[model samples]
Target chain A: MPMNPSLLDNPKSDRIRRVADLANAKARRRSGRVLVEGPQSVREAVAHVPDAVSDLYVLSESEGADTEERSPTLAAIVDRAEQCDSIYIHRASEAVMHRISPNAQGIAAVVDMGALTSEESQVAWSDTPTIAAFWQVRDPGNAGAVIRAADAAGCDAVIFVDDCVDRFNPKVVRSTAGSLFHIPVLTMGADEMLAWCSAHGIAVVAADIYGTPGNAPRTLPDMLADRVAVGQSKAVLFGNEARGLPRQLLERVDRIVTIPIYGKAESLNLATSAAVMLFSLAMSSHMGRM
Target chain B: MPMNPSLLDNPKSDRIRRVADLANAKARRRSGRVLVEGPQSVREAVAHVPDAVSDLYVLSESEGADTEERSPTLAAIVDRAEQCDSIYIHRASEAVMHRISPNAQGIAAVVDMGALTSEESQVAWSDTPTIAAFWQVRDPGNAGAVIRAADAAGCDAVIFVDDCVDRFNPKVVRSTAGSLFHIPVLTMGADEMLAWCSAHGIAVVAADIYGTPGNAPRTLPDMLADRVAVGQSKAVLFGNEARGLPRQLLERVDRIVTIPIYGKAESLNLATSAAVMLFSLAMSSHMGRM
Candidate 1:
């Protein structure tokens, strides 16, 4: 799509307000649209999911020049968006861009929400897939951080089990950096997640400090030492931040593994635990092949 | 010390203002005190370093009943503070407590800065100790998260090398979630850090994705495979949030190791990288002992 010649100068315009409204859950659900803010997110959306992006907004130098003096980073993102014939590009003033989203660092994208949601049937699992699943993760930042961790660990997919913060929330999207576009993220009930894993021969390992009575949690090192078991296809389920996994959920999982704390700190936070556990398993699995 | 009989209802009183001023770096320097906010940090200070706490401020239920209906958690922290006869406990109104520090959840403490700073001479190194160090880490939250990660991984101590964020910053203290009191944290120049590691017969390892010319970085798993070398006393030094360690510093390290990115995400953030690397090394070292 060619760039829109007219610059978006009015911050109060209907188009700008509509773009900003996507930040709200109700607005997003009503319009089936989500705002992807910052250069990193916009660039990834354009590169990987170009067809999903309906509009690309870039900060212009002035009312006259739409493509002049942009930071190399922003210019590159805009250029990438131009290659996608489906993406409509618009140059906006600083105030207009700020109004669309305060976090947009010279660029933001309006994407179709339906295009980002992944179903179980759509997922292409590896021969021995590793999945990262979360239960009732409420914080946007924590949710995003874990997704990035999962992606970095090369997890095949992410499943948000039960109640979770909206994955499309701007803060969550911003926190994921660009990993949100790199991996498939699905939202499903806990039972469905467990059943899907079982059907696919993937074991469900719950990440918790305390296991149910009589089922003491295995230390991560102990789990890693079992190379064959660690290398097997699996889904790691993490609990909420304040309240960990419920006993019912723990009883249903195949196993419980906890990160051992060597010092006096009470426990690791959700995000840190997910990263440590996921990366540890990834490293162990990769090393097993060698 | 008995609790102060009178309630501190005035938010603008000199004593309250002085307590609040500890949040400012300049004020902290002049007074030699730091503000430890939230129940976790205050509780940890009282439990681990009681003598360092000069004053403990807690929110009161009302002007009449100083201690009635306080949350069990806050009441427990207050009880711990009371056992230390040197700690002066004061009850403040909700407005006064909020005025002191917005992040303080029912409790805050005024601690002597001198008590928290660990000099090179004072650190008691463990047998084959592991240390976590950062060079020019600028973010307050990142500094605190890394400190917590180091503590959790059983690092002997943490050294903030070169220019870094003030560890006493309330955000840093709060982000540690009480690990600030669990580990010894020191700030020093890069040369001093390197010299101290050399004097102690400890190897220095730099955590960077890209190593200098002619010296490619080793993957973390490969380093982990070398059990004998990894089990030795070593200090793992991380770089700044944006600009990684300079080539000069990277060249001085015994080894440069990078966490492998199995997926397309660019790289892990400072906190996540620290947790993964520190925990991986810790797990490897612990398993080696077994």
Candidate 2:
């Protein structure tokens, strides 16, 4: 049976009207809280049993609209959480959601974002710790999708450095489709990111679409060709679509690389570029043959 | 100097309204018509031309009262396009553009999409031309983005087969960021696709997230390695994310493949998955060593 709906819709139910802001998302970082947005993601978060989802936001008015798509089933999923705590905001008007979110497909939630803090935070990283670093990438959707690709590539983490989009932004949240809850996202300025790379002994490669940024080898494949510093962490940095990386930032890294584009299409989308690089790393790791 | 403001204020401009549908997009497609949307894209589209834009939309009664972001510069852009025989849609009633497009981002235009579609077709009839085939992709955005990836990967053409999304869909057109105009997108049925593959002597490699439909090879790299028929054309078929390809369809293909995924995360986003395989093929082609 589903959780009691009327209980959540009562006038006393104050939990439903809370605004989610950057402060809320940042608070999650401190208290191990991670915000999960929308209905499908809320359920997935519950299933993953991430650090106890703190709340569920459902439309009190739409609660009466009966369908498996909305209420009771969602309520049941919330009930199945580590705690039976789920609440519906009686005032969740579509306009309210639209105003508050880039696009609130419907529901949103707060869960434990999970235990990844830095690149080295994982003691036992994947055999192929494929890392995608956004260096000055400004698009929120592209940032979110890169995190999703990192998850798909089975990468240990997706990190951001100097001038990249905010990983916690709501638009990025919507684009990730819950991958944000699944992957480790790290952020820092160039000095700090470079410091981590040096200490960890990871091979840092720069991915520039314009091709002038030179690294240890010729091109992307040459870097992928026997570039794995096995038993050491590996990170590849992708930068601004038009300008790529700042010269100082590119120089601090181990190697510079680029995907060979064959047409006059100008440049590939950032997310598409991330997918290609992450997948290439995955293949190299899987084959284990440099 | 910018064109006259009164000319842009006139909504009766006939050439201003031609970009509202596929018939018009196709008309533009035939007569070197190009469509540009949003303030940024429009600005770039106009700056690139003495060639001439087709039409322009400027919301003189701009919403969101931002004086800096959307302003007289937009009016100036419209004025310039108008001088080039481009028509103008003025003070677009909130209802008109909203109905025509919910995502206008305040301005739009019909510009020449780009050069070359008018010159000659890119259809390849040789024995070993490379190609991409989308079996049942349902997202127009993903479909269009895959076309963009194919353009980057140097595939001769992208074929759509069985239950594909509408390629001409606006979301797809926008997602490709005009790369759709660069690639030849052909739609065909299941039988026709298989026949085309066979006739071209293309080794049709099917891609599924879980496993290849029946048993051709375990992963894409393996499939590429095992094709036996070297120097033959290759058509990579990607199936629906949900159900994948039916057994009968898989059996008709020369090979089946999976992307090597590491995370517990079940699958890659459809377009991301497609990009991985496509770039990997291009790598093989460039290296002259699969």
Candidate 3:
């Protein structure tokens, strides 16, 4: 973790331009890397997925000269990256760091997308594995928030089913607040998600306010009280932010459940709904009938 | 219910300028009015708090010349506004609409701030009345989202204790998605909140991750299982988004409870946490012991 002494003062340099370009999807794909900004995100990437992080950038004490790390927060991340043994540390000027990421807060990391892009290999699950899946969740912020909520609920994995936003998007990464490093996030087609769940003996529950005709939705509270269903290995699937789940997708799920609007709110947004439904089931299963 | 034939094509007119100025707090205070943007908020304002609305501005079909309402959504809101005989309906050009509110999706309203500023009078409570209160919630978006979440949870009211974001802020009203009109939102100082709850015989439950010394935080699940607490009149108080509740504030509350994090994800944001905790408690209270 020896710091590179060269001060990256030129924001228009080729290296700086390439790093800034990672904000775009095309550049990320072409370079096979990601720019993880902010101290929390950078630290999480270096700690949880050390193999994925290739470079660490810290803002220097001076404006254009590379001196010491500007803040204790940035220094701590640099120290943590040293223990990882693979991360290359670099100190850049404030302007350079700002150009790298406006949300970076004096620290940023370049991580290999190879480790993040591929799907995790199937593994033997616990007796009652809980997985969170999303279908057509297009908003990066919503996608990240749901992933964080799923992680907090102790889900085994997060599956993005069909036409979802890319997981490596910077806004998604920032909004996840480091939870992206804690769980395996994979992408699959709607059919593939159903088939995968079936092969693994996991029930697929659609978190929809309204189910297709003849398949009315059950309130989340009712589903929680079903001890057998609560204790079973299952995947809770959420819908898009606005349109919600299509009838075709709803018909394939094992159960359609909704978080009841006890008051006058027409509906909860995607992120809030996911947090409530996932945590409710998780807590119910963990705490038993209580 | 008749539509005004005069078209408002001038964005720079004194009337248009005054309506647009409501975006600022000073202007709102001086004029005693607020700018409500988008169809959902305008519709809700007309439906639930008709007396507060003074003017309705709908985007016209043409660019520079005011014409008929351009979209069915805007037309629906305009129709609803017409039902409120006191609400003066005005058609504005696209440029005028944009000047009033950038997010005004073809409709905006000027509502009297008088109806929105005062605290609600004390009311008799149900056996299991639940109230959601926030302390020092500054973020407009989070404030609105929590209001909506509280509404969804069937809370009796939303109390903005201490220094919280203005309830009439255009961003807050927009983020609420009409829930601001669905529930009674009041403001009070910290002392007032405590005194109000005590007078009403409502227990104050502080939702804090880290409880004060000698007062450990109880997990939400365990708290929910306590039937006596769930069925009693209670006020759940959440802290600031980042700093959380102060030690002094926590000491004054009846109980401190927390939502348990089961996975590596560190914590939930203010809006998400409010939704999860409020919905969990509401569902549990409504369904009894389950």
Predicted model with the maximum lDDT: 1
Per-candidate DockQ vs. reference: 0.67, 0.46, 0.85
How would you order the candidates by TM-score, starting with the best? 1, 3, 2
Q: Which candidate's DockQ is highest?
A: 3
Model 3, residue B243: displacement in angstroms? 0.6
Question: In model 3, what lDDT does residue B27 have?
Answer: 93
lDDT of 1 at B23: 84
Q: What is the TM-score of chain B alone in each candidate?
A: 0.97, 0.69, 0.95
- Each candidate: fraction of true contacts kept? 0.71, 0.58, 0.85
Better structure of 2 and 3 per TM-score: 3
- The global Cα lDDT (0 to 1) of model 3 is 0.87
Residue-level lDDT tens digits of model 2 in B23-77? 3546655655555566544664555543545556666463432342446757666
Give lDDT for model 2. 0.64
Error of 2 at B139 (Å): 2.9
Provide the lowest-lDDT 10-residue window in model 3 chain B: B62-71
**Lowest lDDT block of 10, candidate 1 chain A:** A61-70
Model 3 Cα shift for residue A114 (angstroms): 0.8
lDDT of 1 by residue, B179-205 (tens): 888898998899999999999899999
